[model samples]
Target: MATSPGSDIAFASQKSMPSENLRTKKLPLSEEEVFYMNCRAVYLTVFKSSLENIISKDQLYLALQHAGRNPSQKTIDKYWTPQTAKLNFDDFCVILRKEKPTSKAELLKSFKQLDVNDDGYILHTDLYKFLTKRGEKMTPEEVNTIINLPNINADGKFDYIKFCKLYMTTSGQCLKTALERLQVDSKQRRQQFGSHMEELPARDPSSVLKPSPRILRNSDQETLSNRGDPRASLLSTARKFKASVTCTISMAANGNQNAKLTEPNLKDWPGVQSRGCFFLEDDGETVSHQYRLHMAQRSTVHLTIKPLNLSQVEGKLSPWSSVDTALYILKENEDQVDPQLVCFTDLQHREGFGWTGELTPGLYRLLPSTSGCRLRKERTPEPEEAQLVCRDDAGDLFLTQAFKAALSDVFDVIDLDGNGFLSLEEYNFFELRTSGEKCGEEAWLLCREHFDTKKNELTRQGFMDLHLMEANDREGDPCDLWVTLRAMGYNRALELKEACPFVIDLHAERCKPRLKAVRMEASRGQLEKATCQSVLLQGEARAMDGYENVLVHTRSWDFRITSVIENKSDNKVIIHINNELSKNCVNNRGLNVFAVEVAPQSSMVCQHVMPLNEHQEWVHHCVYSLISS
Candidate 1:
């Protein structure tokens, strides 16, 4: 080597250097590996020596730029400062790794697999099935609504690109984790419930197993140390047990039974006639109607009588009471009416019954009848006096009276300024009085927004309209009224039950359709050749008024009516269709006679029209019976 170092000797000398020795120990290093190692060595030697094992802010900026990482101002602020500019080797590696670009191929592949049809588009149904197969018990409608969002497209269809973009963000990752946990829980639930588990077509399990790069890197192993397990919570366990017990009880009660069961008669039961102050002789001529039979401090009895002939009549007795004697007559007469007409009368007095100064509510079944009809009591808890006053069969008359009464009472109480209209403050007070809580900001704003500007306040008419709209909104579902009542401090189960019926009846009066049926007959012409027009009408009278002057289209001919004549005395209406000269008749001189019979104050529309006969021999026919619309 002294004479002229041979190649082998030179190589050996080079490999023996400190840096080379480190590389030689870790043989077969990749290019990247070697580069990083050399960079680390140089960094420690030059940067650490001068900077006390830390790189300065300027040094880090230069180093990051040299390494091809364009750190933003935010990143600089997060990791670099005059006093804490130096970063340890570990911290340096972590920042670089985080900054490293991630390949979207894995996420793309997962989304492609979820798109079952391979059509490049994922529909809500497709997503639903995929999630369900993976054990997510999510509603298809909800999934559909979410997937069809505005940003994705006007049509709400999702493609692979959009899917990846949505799920790759930090917020998206959080959502994905939550959905994954939900799916897992759903799968577990299916297994526990013995429900059928839907399986997806077999494929590479690894394809679905691949997670987003961010999720994988940041995935934390949830420890029981901080939050503990939800299943271990006493309240959660109790709730589950309670739900299970309720389900079991419901199933047992719904199972087949051998004999009809009836409530036992109380000992020394009072005779039906002597039980209450209200009495009706069994003349059997009285038609079925809603009637209040008795009023007591703690109990009230309501009777729904359907007088069928004299000796045989159908009746439903609803007795709300804490006393067993109050229900004795209901039990005794349970066999007198058809089982279908019997109503539930079993009402147990629970603790929260009169908490709101309202009636107690309960549901009792009139033991199974011979006909296998078991009627349960209605769940409306109106005051007996109110029920007596509010009659469903009274048509618009009852509504007008009730509305007037309610308006007068509410106006007297809410008009603090002695003005005809209510100011915002007064309206708020009224709301508080009615619901036991002030109206929310949004509700108050809505009320003010709809105020009559001319009056500059909520007038009686405006108030009525607002309340009517609110009532209409609640008429679709009776349960909504129950929830509202509960929110107004009527939270007891009995109280809700007692109040349900009254609230339902009150709202139903407005929404209820009054049209019974429409009947028509033409007097002249080959009525058989004439086109018959029949219109099955429904809805309120005011709504149908628009159609009153309109001509009704028929298959063969058009029917024009000037107006409908209502017979208030008999609760019937006469519909006169404007007739033309009988063109089909051999003698074209006679006018066609048309007549229709309808319920009084009914919103009637032409339902059906048929030609009588081609014979033209003075034929007369009328609609025999009226059918409920």
Candidate 2:
């Protein structure tokens, strides 16, 4: 009996705990069941953050999905009206399990709702965001199971009709093997792709900064605390010779009590620094004041704030040194605003932050706190302006010699009448053509107040000064200046690089000069600057037409200057005219020593110039040239 019992005991198998019919190795699962399980796993993963079995509306928002797409937040709000709405695990399962066979019209309407851009197709990014960031979120792995459908293009995008036919309308029973393959492919792709970690939201820079109390004198602070300033918040102290305010900017209430601002970096700007910028800030909890320096040389600057502390860095801004701030520099010329926000984070051991750039004489603005948000949220703060007025000292040469030389050439090119200054109209015309920006009248007035000018127009010196101010604000970087130079037809060598396409018809009412056959010649000029040639054409005075009669045939930009004459008067007349090359014109191969006399009604052709080299498009750098009589 003992021997038989030992042999039977060795071979006999015990029963499985849960079920006798199920495989011991794994549970028997259908394709739909596995997908539903994946969905449940995602729901659990997202719910883990709340550390609760129950889910709120937002939690549900992160879980709802249909055919790998999530309903919009607006749709969720339409149904889940209560803010404190909750759903248990069973309820969530019921919601996920419920689905109706949608008709073609209903599907089309749904697709139309998602296709807000009406692009006919949905972008991969849009789909991903919809499934993962909208009313209910889904895992990328699960979403990709559908994304790997045969219809998806190399770009991971496709028409909604394809999605409907493949994932929505198709029977789950038929998609078993394909779905299984898709799951495997998606997992392999994810493995090859790298990290699937969701990035945390961007940290607000202002979060690191201790909200500073307003900057004010002791008496002023006390007065402000008692009963706000009777005067406007934006006070003006725009005197030229005023003493600089204390460099130390009093700190606001910072998070770390240990960060003690022992000293200031100093107001070490290049020019005479005068700041009378004033403003105020009131957090919901407390009231304080903020101020920007007034860069007043003349007209007042309107300030605006973008509520957000924009972070230039993408992620992991850690162990930030003491709380820091930055300067936003702006140039206010009426409607012209070039806002620059600069931040020089202090070293770990440094006491405070300072922006130590030198400046030239002109109106400048410093705007801090760029908008951190794409849309305006109630929480983000607006941008504030500080008035910082800096003037050039007696001995300081603001513009470098080379820059001045180049700008002098630029001024001459803009002065169409060969006059010594640029009218606002002329400046705006050139600006619109070259930069696609129009200089507003307010900006013009601002320039007049700050820079040297004659006839209420921009003088050559003033032009140079404006550029100097721009260069200094950028810490002597010549990038912006170079753009203007090139646009104005100047080369790297500061030589005129192109012929001005515009003609300044100064005396057009009487006689107009025009370059005929605007199309460049077959043999283009080899260089950017137009080539010029001159030979004195001897002609006797005779009855002829005036300036309108001269036809300038521009061939290969070979000719730079031509005079047009037309006789508007009934009486025939002989006129004496001068043929001269502008001292400012580039690549001038002609001389100005000849005077030509023409018979009335007869055309007088000055020496026609041709390009020296015959294979490039040349723009005559003569922005303006004059033929005088």
**The candidate that achieves the highest TM-score relative to the unseen native structure:** 2
Cα error, residue 492 of model 2, in Å, equals 2.4
TM-score of each: 0.16, 0.22
Q: For model 2, how does the per-residue alpha-carbon lDDT over 452-514 read when each residue is reduced to its tens digit? A: 889888888877766666555555545555556544444456544232211111011111112
Candidate 1, run of 10 with poorest lDDT: 241-250
Residue 40 in candidate 1 has what lDDT? 44
Candidate 1, 1-629: lDDT as tens digits? 00112212110000111224323553464444433332343233223232243446655544443232434434444555444634654445444544442234655665666566787677655655654454323344434433543234334456656534432332222223233333444433232111112222334434322323322444234221111111111111121111100000011221123322222332332212111111111211111111222212233233111101111125432222111111111111335332122232222222001101111222211111000001112235544322102225532212234444444434543454445677665555544334434455555445555544234467777665554444344332224333333322232332212111100000011121111101111111211111111111211121112123222222111111112222233343223322222222211112233323344443333332222222322211211111101
Off by over 4 Å in 1: 1-261, 267-400, 404-629
C-alpha lDDT of candidate 1 relative to the true structure: 0.30
The lDDT values for all models are 0.30, 0.34
